[model samples]
Structures are given as C-alpha cells and as structure tokens.
Target: MMKLGFDGKVALVTGAGSGIGAAVSRQLAEEGAEVVVADLNGDAAQTVAAEIRSLGGQAQHIAVDVSDPDAVERLVQFVIDRCGALHLAVNNAGTDGVRKATADYPLDEWHKLLNVNLNGVFYCMKHEIAAMVQNGGGSIVNMSSILGCVGLPTASAYTAAKHGVVGLTKVAAIEYARMGVRINAVGPGWIETPLLLDHSDTVSTRRMVALQPMARRGTPQEVSALVCFLLSEQASFISGSYHLVDGAYTAH
Candidate 1:
C-alpha cells in the first residue's frame, strides 16, 4: 500500500512481457509514469502495454533482444524518440540458463546465458546512462538473482552471470553517481514467475519452498515493490547497493 509518485516520468522496463518485468511495468504506470514495455516477445509486450492502457495508464510496447548491442542502442533511441526523454529504467531482461555443473555446462549455453543475463545489462546501462545523463539525472534497477550473492548446486552458468550483474551494477553506479544516475541490483529468491515454473517441477518447487523461512514462494508483485522504490525519489540516497527480496533464503 506504499504507493510512490512517478508523475511525468518516462520509464523503460525490459522483459516487460511477464513476471517481475510485467509487474514492474504495471505498477509504474499506475503510479503515473509513462511506461515503455520492452520484451523479446512482441505479443506479450503488446499485451502488457495494452493492459496498462486499459487500466487508464499511459504505456507503449516494443520488442527487442537485449543481448544484441545494436538492438539495445536502437531501443534507447526508440524511447527517446517516442517519450521525448528517458528518466527511469529497469534492466530486468534475463534468462535462467539450464541447471548444470560447471564442468558439465555446455559452451554455447554458457555464452548465450552470459550474453542476456550479464552483457545485456552492461549494454543497457551503457546506453541508458548516456540518455539519463543528458536528461540531467535518473535511476535504474537491474534485476539480479539471489544467485548473484550465493552459489547454487547445478546452476553454474546462472550463478556466474548473476554475480557478474551485481559487479557490473556496482561499477556503473559509482561511475555515474556524480552524473546523477543511480544504479542498483535486486536479488529475488524463489519468485513465482515463468522462469521458476518453467524450470522447476512440483517436487523441486516444494523442496525449494521448504527451504524458505517464509514457507512459500515470493510473488512478482513483491519484487516489483522493491524495484519501483529503487527507481523513485524515495530511494534517492540509495545506489550501488544490492537488495534482496528473498524471503530470508540466504539468512541461513
């Protein structure tokens, strides 16, 4: 129930097609931000954007693969061209690579995973920061995973990529602090999202839930609450920090 104001702000959320990304997009729009919903799935993006519009909010949709640098450049330009200015962003586009041991991970999957999960964030920040600087100042929330802070069995590639995201976020935050851009990472644990459902079975999910102190899965809306705060004036003094919405999974 802690609604923050984002009136007149233009915000971009990558991977806005579903889950946390979609949740973030909707909340931002409801809070008075003109949201640009970007995702690899054009249909899903359109759907989310349309939902916001139906709810009496302003929104637009775009399809772009963040893993592609050239595409990312175009994405930023698109935002500027359509929105007139870019003041906020959430680099939430990412993939959960197959769970495999380091020694058994496939080379191609590793590269692909890194491309979207890690390099993609860098590419987004590179362009987003430039635009934000021109706009005077802005805030960004990068979606990292609980894996970013700790290791998980059979998840070498994902853990590595997420860890890289945390490091990248910190570096960019420091470099842009004086430029009026604040960057931070969010680490979510066992969120009930497509990424989780697609990769986890009943037994596996239950087992994971059992490990949580909350004894249940976190919702995408829960994660969005933190994301929206980070991109708002409420978190003006918060930057270069890694935040967790993990239900105390790491408490142990």
Candidate 2:
C-alpha cells in the first residue's frame, strides 16, 4: 500500500528461499527492483528467482553463507557486476531454530547460533556498506527479533544474537548517516515463517499471540510491507531506528 520506490534499482536479499525473506524479495521485485535471491539452499533460491521471473519480475539467485566474510564479499561483488549497482540490501540470514533452554544449551550451540545471527549480519553490513558507498548511498534493513528487545524462556541464544543485531544496526546507522546511507532494523514478533513452523501447533505460538495485544501472530507479508517502506526513499528521515512490527506485543 505504501507504493515504495525500487524502480530500476537492484536489491540483494539473504535467506530468501522461503518465509519472510522470500516475501521481502517478492515484494521488492514487484516494485520493479531487480532482486538477487540469496540463500543457503541454492536450489530454493533458484526456484524463487524463477518464480519471480514468471511473475513479470526481474530476479536472480545466488548461494551465500552470510556468516562467512568471504562469501559475503563475493555476494556483494556479484550483485554489482551483474546488476550494475547495489542500492538496497536486506540482511536476513540466520539460525538458532533448535532452540534449547539456556540451562541445557551447550556452548558450542551458542557459538553456532551467534556465528550466523550476529556475526553474519555484521559481515553483510560490512560488504554491503562498502558497495553502497561506491554507489553514493543505499538502504539496509537488518532482521532482528522481538526477543531482541524482550526476553523469553528457551531463547537465550536467539535473544542475545538479535539484540546484537539491533546494536550493530544502530552503530552503523549513526556512523553512516551523514553519508546519505540509512541503516535500520526490524524486530518481528512471532511472524509466520519457517522459524515458527516447529512451534506452530505447539503452545508457544498461541502463547505468543496471546501476549500480543493484537491477539494474533503476524504474516510474512505484513512484515514485508514495513520493510519495503523502510527501503524506500519516502523514509529518508528514518534511520538508525529499530521498528517493532509486533502488533503491540511490546506495548504490553
């Protein structure tokens, strides 16, 4: 509904093979952005890209591990070489799904979680910002979590990593504000993504919805709309901020 601007621009989206990442990539493609769908599952990424092309959208696909600095660098360069420029980037790759309560969680488990969710975001921003600087300016949206602001049982690693994402987003936003680049983050609450599938039929999602004043979990598309606006020039004044698209989950 915001009718954001992406006409002729190029976007790079990670974890875009499914769920919220897929939704974001589709939304941008629909808005005339030439999107590069990056995911750990190369086949899935290719599938999404093909679907976008079928829907009268411009899209490409690439396999990337956002946690690896070298992979991130190559991904950025691929976008520039193929798409001509990189005006938008969404750092959405992460993991921690096999969530165990802190008391039972292993240190190695925690390390793996942080490697993807926190360090991965940092790697993406480092390479993406470098490219954006060369192109004058651009927009970046980092995927955080409602747990980034609030705490929940059995989500210690995820919470820590997401909070790190917010902190990283803020720092980058401030450091680059004067350079025409806007960096921000989205803290999605109980969204309908693959990450929630394990908890879908369980008491967790329902409990999460109950906690939300809106009384429901949000959809991938719902979050995508907010992200689209942030990437648009319309939100030029909005930067360095973490927006909670939680349907008032944090309000209570």
Candidate 3:
C-alpha cells in the first residue's frame, strides 16, 4: 500500500488563515505532520491552528508577510528553531484585486499584484530553501494559478506574475533536485474561495462555471488534495513540474 503519512515531519503553510492555505494546513496535520500555519492575518492563522489542535493535530500560528524578506526569514527560522528541522513548505500566499485592462491598470495595482503574487513567492523560497538545505533536504510547493499557465483577458499583472512563478519553480526545482530538495508549483482554476467573492460568492462562482468543462468551480479542499500529495514522499520523482488543477478550464 502507498502510505500518505507525514510522521515526524514539520510542514509550514503560508496564507494559511483561510481558503486553500487553511485547507492544506488542516489536511497536512491530519496526515500526522506538525504544521505551522502562517498568514499575513495573524488572528486568522491562529484560528486555523486552533482548529487543527482541537482535532488532535499538532499546529501553531505565525504571522508572516511573504512580501517582506525579513519576515519570511523569521518564518523559516521559526520552523527551524521550534521544530528542529524543516521538511515541507507551501508558498500559498497571494492576492488579486479587481480586473482592469492593461491600458488602464494603475501603477499601484500592478505593484500590488506583483508584490504579493510574484515577489512574495521569491522571498518565501529564498529563506525556506536556505533553511531546508541546512537541515539536509525538504520539499516546497508554490501556489501558482491557471493564470500562470495561460493568459487571461484583463489579468495582465496577475498573468505576468504567475508566469514568473512557473519559471521560478522550474529553475529552482532543477537547481535543488539533486541537492536533497524539490520544488514544484500548483495551478488552480476558478475556485469559490472567499477571497474570490467578498460579497457574492454564489453569483460569482456561477459566472466562472460557464467557462469550465466541469460546469462547476473547484473547492479549496479539492486543490488541497493535490497539494498534500505533492508534499508527500510519494511524489519523490516530481520536481520542476507545474501541475494544473483547473477543472479543465485550461484544457479548453
């Protein structure tokens, strides 16, 4: 039998306060890993960690601003200091605001998307990889998007940023594959995350489903399922790979 256990290992998930990040943190803990739930929203992260603990799973909360290099370094150091070894990391933190045409996209919006979407991943990886290498080896999963693989109509900055994520994952994956570390990326399609619908999730999700081959959007847990598998040793031979879970959106 192929066991998907994470015994005696430590897993860190960024943006774990809610949505897919939270789902991944919970699932990883259920599989027997000591999980660090880090998010820019401290209270939210703590809440998720508490839920894991309530379920008899080991978890703790840390406030992390992935866009900030210093903060990312401290996050990795926290895992190393508290857990003694860092085994797995998920750079799942990101942001995408209202869609605007490239010609009208404000500079602030461009900077904002790039800062959290692309630069943040780089910051997390730099620190996480450094710590993982020191402790021998570890695995990393970067949360990219279908936007990372294909161009979207009005998501110029988001598309560009995600494309950068795919490139970064490939380069880093190749660089660390033989050195006891592996890096991969996950591209999620239109999911009904709270982040996607601040006001009307049901209506928004329906609109998105019209474009999907599945005739429905995905769930945070569904995305987390693939994420957990990629984080496990069962995926040992999978590195420098960008796995898509876009509900057949990209297939068309």
Candidate 4:
C-alpha cells in the first residue's frame, strides 16, 4: 500500500480556500505533507489553514494574487523561508469570467480572465519551477478544465485561458523533465465548485449536468484524489500531459 506516499514533503496549493484546491490541501496534509493553502481571499485561506491545523495537520496559509509575477515570486520564497524546500505545488487558482459570445465579449473581461486564469498559472509555474530545481526535484499539478480540451459557447475567455494552461504545462514539463521537475495539468469537468455554482443558474446547472455522460457534476474530493496522486511519488513517471477528471463531459 504505497498510498500515494507524501510522508515528508512540503506542498503548496493555490486557490485552496475552497472547492478542489481546498480538498487537495487537506488531503495532502493528511498524507503527511506540510501544506500551504494559498488563495486570493486572505480570510478564506486562513480559515482553511486553521481548520487543517485543528485537525492536527501541519498547515499554513497565505493570500496571493497569482496574476502578478512579483507576488508569485514572493509566494515561492515564502514557502522556502518557512519550509526550507518546495516539494510539490498545485497552481489551481483561476476565474471563470462572465459569459458572453466571443464577438460580444468585453475587452476588459478578456484581459481580466486571462490575467488570473492563464497568466497566473504561468506566473506560479515560473517561480515554483525555480524553487523546485534548487531543491533538486519536485512535482506540479496545474489546474485546467474540460474547456481546455473543448470549447463551450459563451465562455470564450475561460476556454481560451484553460487551453493555454494545457499548452504551458506541456512545454514546461518537457523543458524540466531532465531536471527532476515533473509537471502536469489536471482538467476537471463541471465540478461542483463556487466557480460554477456561483455563476450558473438552476437551468444552466441542469444544462451542464445534461452535458456530462455521468448526468451529474463531480465532487471536489474526487478531483483532489487525482491531483494528489499526480503530486505524489506514485506518479513519478507521469508528466507533460493533461489528465481529465471530467464526468466524461468531453467524451461526446
């Protein structure tokens, strides 16, 4: 029973205040990793970290806007200063901008979504890879989405950013494979996260459900399981690919 072994590792998960990111942070903590729960919401990040601590898990929290390269640098540095090494990271922070047809999409909205969704992943990876290389080796799981592989109407910006994430993951993984850094992307379907629920109406939700062959949305824990496995030694040979946890939403 290898159990995805993380006995003595330091893991950082962004957007970990809630949903899949939060679940991954907690699960990583349970696997004996010192977890750093990073999110844009300072209070939310602290709450999650405090909850992990209450459960006797070694955990910490930080508020970081991943879109800023400078802030991302500071974040990785913070992890090094506090934990001494960065063994694993999940660049999961992102946003689903307002829905609109590509032709009707607002220019500001497009930039805003890309800044956090696509550019943010790049920023985090840029710094995380450096820290991991310095530490000799590490793993990373960047959050993509079902949209990364396919397109959805009225979600032009989100779809584009996610697709970009997949490309970025592939290029980085290839570049760092020989350097002891394995990078991969996880594409989650319509998981029941605030990112979807907060933006969807009842009818919209039902429509999304119908789109999935599973006829339901996925749970954060389900996705977290996959993310943790990828970040663990069990997945040492897996890198430079996009793994989907979608409920077969893209099968059709």
Candidate 5:
C-alpha cells in the first residue's frame, strides 16, 4: 500500500465539531494538511481546532450555516484569505430530519432537512469548485449515507436528500473532471456517532445494524480513513463515484 500524505495542503471539513467530520479533520492534520474545522456550532468548532493545535497540527475553526449559499461562499473566501489556497474539502454537514412516513412527513421539516443535507452540500460545492478551479485543481468528498442508496422506513426526507447528494456528486465530478477537480460521494453505514448512539435502543437502530454484514456499527475513524484516501493522490483516477463504508449493509 502506498503511504498517503497531505503535506503543505489546505483542507476544509464542515461539521468538524464531531463524529466523522471531526475525525477527518484530525486525520488530515495528522497527514500534514492545514485544516479548517467548520461547523454551525462555533464553540464546538473552536474546541476541535484547539485540540488539533495541541497535537501540533495546523488548524482553525469557522462557524457557518452550510444551508446558506452566502455563508458557504464566505467560508471558501475565509479559507483562501487565511490559508492562501483551498485544496481539499469534505462537505460533511448534515441532518437526519424528523422520522416519519413520507405521507406523514411535515412540510416544513422536509424543507428543513433538504436544505441542510442536500442544498447545503450543493452550496458548499458551488463555491469550493470555483476556488479549486482557480487554484488549478482539488478534491471533494460529499458525505452521503447508506440510506442514500436504499430506503428506510420513516426516513423519507433523509433518504431523498442523500440520494440527491449521490446524483449531484456524479454531475459535478463529470463537469469538473477536465478542470482537474475530482468530486465524489461517500456513503457511510450506521457509524457509531453520538447521534446514532443516542438512539441505540430504537427499532430503527437495531434494524440498521442487522442489515450490515459486519453485524455492528462502524466508527468515525473508519469513515474518515476512506474520506482522506479519496481526497489524496492515491485516488488520483477515482472521481464521480459513490464509495460506501457501510460494512456491506447494502449488499443484500
């Protein structure tokens, strides 16, 4: 296996306050990349950045609502102004939305879910792509879910938004391939995140685990490993693809 490194690279990871996002930020920093830990929760973002600094890694925190296009644009600009270039990005900010059947799903809730999970990724990608192009090239990893490829009861909105991410990733990857930008989507299974752990006893959680061939939930570090690889030169020829870290959850 080839050892990967992000020496002198600049990376931006949204939702970096916790879970897979935080793990990715740390991993990138460990690999010598100057990382930006971005999240809507300012304090959480700052905490993560502080942790990275303590580990002797270069990192900073930025607070922004990814659902807002203006905020997304400003995020890119802030990175450039501070770091001088934007080379790697992981659009990991997302929400699970309200759990309800499609017919019973609240209208406002649907819009809210899509705005962050789907539109948020789009907004980030739009500005990130422009910046990457100007910098000559870069890589992006959009966080999707195994739900993106399969349906789940009472998760209609979340499912739809994730599916949309996979589609959007494909289109963006193709359009930007010639320009040297490689964009891809990552479909994670039921990772052991705080959000999932909080619902560990729920029927939905049990069902999710049973579907996985591994018969257990994955970890944030596991997903982060894949995201970092996709963002590195080791995956040079990989683009416009949806890589799943779901422990064969969808194998059936």
Candidate 6:
C-alpha cells in the first residue's frame, strides 16, 4: 500500500454514509485528513463519523440533500466554519434513476435523476472551487460511472447524467488548473455496494460478471483506494481526466 499523508488537510465527501463514499471517508481520515461525512441519511452519516472518531480520527457529519443548491452552499460554509478550510472534496453523492429505455423513461424521474447526479456535482463544485481558490489550491474528484463512457440498455437517465458529469469535470479542470485546483472524474464498474446489491439477482449477477473482464465485482475499498490517490499529492499532475476503475469493462 502506498501511504499518503493528509496532515492538517480537510476533506468533504458527499454520500459518505455508505459504500464507496464511506470507504473513502474512512481511508482519508486514517491518512490524517479531517473528514466531513455528508449524506441525505442523517443517521448513516453520523454512524460513519462516529466510527471514525472511535478510531481516533477526526470526522464530522452533516445531513445534506445535494440536489438542493442552497443546501450544498451551506455544506461548504459548514465545513469552513468547523474545519477552517476546505482543501479536498469528493462530489460522490448521486442516485441510480429508474431503469428504463429512453423512450419509456418517465419525465419526472429523468428530471429527478439529473437534479441529483449531474446538477448536484455542479453545485458542489461551484462552492468547493470558490473555497479552494481562497485557500490557495485543492483537488476534487467527481463520481461518475462506467455508464458515463458507454450506453447501457434500460439505463438511459443514469447514462446521460454520468456523461454530463464527465463533461463538467473536464471543463472545470481546464478552467481552474492554473489556479491550483485539479478536477477529475472516476468511472467505476459494478462494485459491491448497497446500490448494486439492490439490483443484483442471479440473472443480474451473471450479466454484471460477464461485462467485466475480471469476471467479478469490485469491492468498495478498491474504488476508495483510487479516490484517495486522486485527492492526494500523488496525483498532483493529474486533472481533467476520467479514470475507469472498471475491471477493463470498456476494453471491449
């Protein structure tokens, strides 16, 4: 394991309540970063924060709905007020919208999905980048998905939102690279997360395995490891890039 230091650095991870987000929060805290666990589920966020504290790591919890721009702004201010600075952020809060073909996808669900997955990242970056500029420099990782780079049957809304995330990340990276802020995106394949489990029946499991060249599902830790690297100085030269931790699912 490559050890990276985050001493005196503050990180904000949305969706830190579970899955990859929770894993990232714990790893960052273990590496000496004060982590803010933000999630729409208040209880889950608090649980993750408390667990970090028990391990003698610094962590705080905030209940937030990322789809709300006002709430995201408040989240940034809260971190500044409590931690005094925002040096890292992971815009990982998102939702898997209803699985349906584009022609059959409900308009309301499409709007709702885009609101959280796409617009939410933009709102977070808007506030997080401003804070980073004031603090000199920082790094940001936006959570996209393998679907972002390819189309999936019955997943029109999700694919569109994730694709938007990739585009947004690239634009922000170019606009702020000189200012010391590095923006990037992570495209994950089928991982062992609750969201995935919810849809994983025997049939789905076979399908997912067949899609990945590795012939298996990835663990949350696997994704978190990549995310931590991006947020660390180890990835100082990296920006405006979409990294796929997809078990070579897109290679074909």
Models, CA RMSD each: 1.1, 1.3, 1.8, 1.1, 1.0, 1.1
lDDT score, candidate 5, position 70:
94
Give the distance in Å from residue 189's predicted Cα in candidate 2 to where it truly belongs: 0.7
lDDT of 5 by residue, 1-252 (tens): 455679999999999999999999999999999999999998999999999999999999999999998999999999999999999999999888778888999999999999999999999999999999999999999999998899999999999999999999999999999999999999999899976877778798787787778878899999999999999999999999999998888888
Candidate 3: worst-modelled 10 consecutive residues by lDDT: 199-208
Given candidate 4, what's the lDDT at residue 207? 82
Q: 1-252 in candidate 4: lDDT tens per residue?
A: 357778789999999999999999999998899999999998999999999999989999999999898999999999999998999999999998888888999999999999999999999999899999998999999999988998888889999999999999999999999999999999998888998888667565568777789878899999999999999888889999999998778888
- Report lDDT (Cα) of residue 159, candidate 5: 92
Candidate 4 weakest ten by summed lDDT? 199-208
- lDDT per residue for candidate 6 within 1-252, as digits (tens), equals 687889899999999999999999999999999999999999999999999999999999999999999999999999999999999999999888777778999999999999999999999999999999999999999999998899888888899999999999999999999999999999999999988887787464468667788888999899999999999999999999999999998888
Evaluate residue 151 in candidate 1 and report its C-alpha lDDT on the 0 to 100 scale: 85
Q: State each model's CA lDDT, in order.
A: 0.94, 0.91, 0.89, 0.92, 0.94, 0.94
Candidate 2 segments whose C-alpha is farther than 4 A from its true place: 202-205
TM-score of every prediction relative to native: 0.97, 0.96, 0.95, 0.97, 0.98, 0.98
Query: Model 3: per-residue lDDT, tens digit, 1-252?
Result: 345789998999999999999999999998999999999999999999999999999999999888888888888889988988889999999888657778999999899889999999999999888888988899999999998888866679988999999999999999988788999999999787876666344554455667789887789999999999998989999999999998889887
In model 6, where do residues sit more than 4 Å from their true spots? 202-205
Write one digit per residue (lDDT tens) for candidate 1, span 114-185: 999999999999999999999999999999999999888777888998999999999999999999999999
Question: Which residue runs does candidate 3 get wrong by more than 4 Å?
Answer: 199-207
Error of 2 at 157 (Å): 0.6
2 against 4, candidate with superior lDDT: 4
